[model samples]
Target: MDNDFSVDLDDILATLRSHDIVIARFVTVHRRLLFDFRSTPLDPPLVAAVDPLPSIEARYRHLRELRPRLGDPPKLVTVFWPRFVASLADTPAWQAVRGRLSASGHPGAVESADAALAGLVDLERAAQREAILGGRAFRTIWSASPSPR
Candidate 1:
């Protein structure tokens, strides 16, 4: 696991549980699986790629609305590796979301999130290179390129 891409699963679970949100994990190899979590075997919602504006927005809205009710912020944990570049490149929705996020102005939450995500990509790439040289299985690699905007 990349230190820059660290996510405390236990903390996330506690936060979700505090808000009465059930967390589930599912293992699938399909992009469309993101459309409906229920259709998958995962229990706690897992974050893979930050794409699909409508779907992401809907989920955010749902969690935002649930926050007050649950008395805590909704917890979402996502893990991505170097291969995210190819995977995301193949998805139009992912590209669109990436554009929107990268275009966000500075001095705001969006900017901060964008920076953090970019850092995670860098770390993933480094990890992938290390794995390749070590003769290990291909790991997910995320090529972090700064937005030209």
Candidate 2:
């Protein structure tokens, strides 16, 4: 399977459409991907996309590479990747980019984030299931506790 987290734009757009989130504007500025949308054609819970988000396997490999110095590689991998997803909208990098986009009067400059995220989660769950065997694959793959010291 492809290890990269790169997602197909058309597939993602289809998922967003399925969620009934209207795409006000979707653009990539300076190679940073962003999407602007509302929960419905006219509504609240605006959302934007932020990506290059790593996959579970990629994240696991990265931590494993740290080797002897790494404390509980599986644990770190489990905690970090989900944390990365949760913190996407709050990241300073994304917030700064959002600020600039809003200042420039760009459409989809993240008013408040959500609906698209929900759809993206749905897409991610399906993809990951196919990659492994089932949902929350990380939990199964990383469930082994570190050997006792």
Candidate 3:
């Protein structure tokens, strides 16, 4: 018998578009696994999410083709494994990842891999800003506040 799992690409794409992240589950003939995408934004967050390995591979290929077409290359790419939740939680990986992403380029290109499925939403946002400012003059302004624990 063929032992393989299946995933809903549309659902995965939607989650990425909305949350910018995903933790999915997968069940094969013998075992279950998680797909996490807390590392590279170019790869789908499938380490925890239940998606067939083949499906994940296919998606990656498609995204690779789509990314540059939208605009400039993104800065950071991260992938996380749910099985190492404790290790990730205890380390500075998340902060480091965010930092890398922040430094990659403008936040305009710093979309999570999951969010990339929304058909160049980042480019659209950038275009809007360009239209308003007459150029790529934009910045992220923030108010000063104490870090919340």
lDDT of 2 by residue, 1-149 (tens): 32344434444334343332222222211111233222222322334433333565653453344232433222221101222242344545345434543543435544434444444545554655655764533345554688666
Q: Estimate each model's TM-score.
A: 0.29, 0.27, 0.27
Per-residue CA lDDT of model 1 for 64-116, tens digit only, reads: 45332333333433332223433333444334333443443222433443354
- Candidate 3 C-alpha lDDT tens digits along 1-149: 22233334444444433343333321211122222223344532322212243565554554454343333223222232333222222334334333444544434333552233222334444555675566645454543686666
Per-residue lDDT of 10 in model 2:
49
* lDDT (Cα) of model 3: 0.35
Error of 2 at 121 (Å): 4.1
lDDT of each: 0.36, 0.37, 0.35
Clashing pairs in 2: none
What's model 2's TM-score?
Answer: 0.27
Off by over 4 Å in 2: 1-84, 111-121, 128-149
